[model samples]
Target: MTDSFLTISGFRKTFGSIVAVEDVSLNIPKGEFLTFLGPSGSGKSTTLYAVAGFDDPSAGDISIDGRSILATPPHKRNIGMVFQRYTLFPHLPVGENIAFPLRVRGHSAADIAKTVKAMLSLVRLEGFEDRLPAQLSGGQQQRVALARALAYDPPVLLMDEPLSALDKKLREEIQVEIRRIHQETGVTILYVTHDQEEALRLSDRIAVFNHGRIEQVGSGEDLYARPATRFVAGFIGDSNFLKVREVERRGSAASAILPDGTRIENIPAHAGNGHAATPELMVRPQSLKFVQGSGAGLAVKVKDVTFLGDTSSVLLETGWGQEIWLRGAGSAVKTNALSGPLHVEWNPADSHLFC
Candidate 1:
């Protein structure tokens, strides 16, 4: 892409028999907040370590601005890193913690002071410079760690589940702070996390990993709206699945018949060549709507409805034990209008037919 500045190509790592990363390739644009999002043991952290020079790749290369940096050591890589735990020195003051990187890089005392001051402001920890990291809140400590990383003015930054230690509200506040800082400084960032909402909220693009290989790499909308595989469809979020009893590949648009004899027309399924024939249909609960229609969609009985404030979820089932989920406003399902045999219609664009 035109925005690409840091390109990681064909990077792989193995621990004896187990592979941590396999042919991981992605272009991280300069000034973009890119996130490696996946579950635990999925190699997101390992990949971050590889890029930061903590873990060398068994194969492939990591390059910045089209030049390979695979041989560069962590301290010399000009990449700042903030770990999940605040790895700060106990004896050093918060200001000293931020200035240590600069001091080691041969910056004079005056330069270090100036740099540390600016860095402290960047993380909004200017006033607490004299205090120790242990004296601060979890959020404050994390901010100090961030300030320390950015103190040396590294061109690239790496973060590994940095806010996992904080509470949800604080984590969210720090997330927004991180996003704003990235925007203001235009530093290239490679953030690692397992939270889908965090990835969707803070990333320029998210690389989803599974079994050490990239399941799909795309914008949040791309991955969420148009997932590439069943793993992605089910993993990133919830989906109501139905077995494909019959397949009718009609040109670009294909239709699959569910076990309930309900025919759902899908918006052109891309050929899944290597996958086994585990026939299924995946659709977001929001796709299915309880509307007034006949001989269209599926006939389902509302088994339960859950209120989630913004959107209400309705769980339904077919006579033959197939399940369906519908999403709407919380107040919409109070009436008994949708409890009985109701028509559950989903747009062809919303459903994906997999065979």
Candidate 2:
């Protein structure tokens, strides 16, 4: 059995009339990096708050290593937290800021010194110890906040879009730094972010939340390769959805009739995302091929073509009036050549059902 460092079962939270998180359950393996990914009002941050003890649950239990911590105060929970903004003291130096948590915990001066030194090394902020928050760069100050969070040696780390304020390049850099720190320390990390790329790039597992509930929980590959529902399929990545016009079942194999009178045989997408809302099947741009043969491919009229230097994206309108997006790499294909007639073909397995 995998050892769960944190297990949240049926955890719920409500703010007056609004339900922020409802009966969400998940098991986070020890030392594994888990991320809560969803858009705003989807309850990703609310779940993190429940785990951090900032908001007590309206129902259910939050256990760390098989013991309940629902009653534990925020300070007593021993969690490391990095918020969206760098919450460092403006008047204090970097060293003093990182030492604040240790000071609060009543550590000896010598012990604080040792822990601070180790944390600085871990976050690669060793030399910036003397610099004040205003003196250091944005990335450096962010690293100081991360170092401070780690100073207490908390087993679990909670990050709520810590790098959201930085530019893309700096954000990527700090993301790598955080990954390195996690690998080096083997601490259980619970990250929350609305950025899909960040979740895909950082987590051992990505739990997609929707409307105050967990929609799906699995590795990045699991989400992209096999999304549990249409919400997850549409939210986790870029996908083109086409509604299922009809479905024909035969034994274990099934077929779905598409909008263009095309049938996809022996595919699970025929039923859509199992018992949930019947949505259209998603056809990824990368999974499509421009073919010239007798197949069940949808015929389309190329409306526009964009040159992306290395790659090109084609926008088209199908005979069924559905817009199709295709991505490929070649001599930037002109829109004029593809304007008259175009067909999109792919393997049946590439279709992700939305029903």
Candidate 3:
């Protein structure tokens, strides 16, 4: 943490009576790929804007390499930004568009041409410099935008949902390109997006935001496996929540009674009070397995089955009418042949307790 290249400490932002971001802070190392991931209006974008010097924070400080930049104007921050919409100048050709940033920085014409060529090669669009923005496809235009952003060789790059405008296939393709560019350039990047898959695919560490606050920040596996809050567990991945009443507690973990009176133990009580009066069981579909007959678990009836090529998802309803889902290998569960009673069982350690 002492070697942090970018630091956001106690950041808070407000607009009139509305508080957009509050109490947000993070430490990013040099050449790190960190992502701000959350639903809309969760303050992710607001935090990024503050770092870019677009809006001054009501409280807290933002520093790059230990120097505060709160008073710096947006244009003087030397940060590159790529927004959701393509902001290319319509009249400028692809090559010139990438050269615009260099020209603004007063680089010599000879140096600008060299940088433009390198950027074009970096984005894998070497021969399209003569093409106009309108004449290029959406994916190609976004690539050019990326090339332009990197042309100036800014130490920090901020991306605000840059891939939101493209289709799924194109979006995925660009995600790969972004990763490659990050590796080749080694520039510290702060990317913003709401897509869980995209965040998991791209970030080395992710900060989850909600209602102007950061709920959690960690590696993809850490957040997915050991979430600190109920909201984080539900938001970062697919989860099925089952209502449960607290049966007992010991130390930091607790036990709870399921709907069918089956007891589950060793669940982490993240509330840290050693007690959760009203706790819900968070079980992933992949953790549940179909049992042949009723044992020490919840018995449910098959409601529906969906085959998704590599895996099949089975929807089950408890006797109390609560729905639960289980994912299995594609050939493991027959969608049409599924019939009769099926019980769902899981190891207590595989489940989480959230109150």
Lowest summed lDDT window (length 10), candidate 2: 268-277
* Colliding pairs, model 2: 272-355, 273-355, 278-355, 279-354, 279-355
TM-score per model over all chains:
0.95, 0.94, 0.95
Tens digit per residue, CA lDDT, model 1, 1-355: 7766888889999999889987799888788888899899998899999989988899998999989999888878989999998788879999999888887788998898898889888998778889987898989988898888888778899999999998999999999999999988888899999999999899998889887888888889988788887777777777887766888887767888777677766565755422657677788987777768677667788888787888888888876777777888788666467655777777888777665
lDDT of 2 by residue, 214-267 (tens): 888999998888787778888877788877787676653467887878777766
Q: Number of clashes in every candidate structure?
A: 0, 5, 0
Q: What's the lDDT of the predicted structure labeled candidate 2?
A: 0.84
Candidate 3, residues 1-355: lDDT per residue as tens digits? 5489999999999999999997999999999999999999999999999998988999999999999998899988989888889889999999999999888889999999899899999999989989999999888988899889888888899999999989999999999999999999999999999999999999999999988999999999989998888888888889998888555778768898877687888877666212345678888999888777557577889998988999999999987789989999999887766788877788877788876
Q: What is the lDDT of candidate 3?
A: 0.89
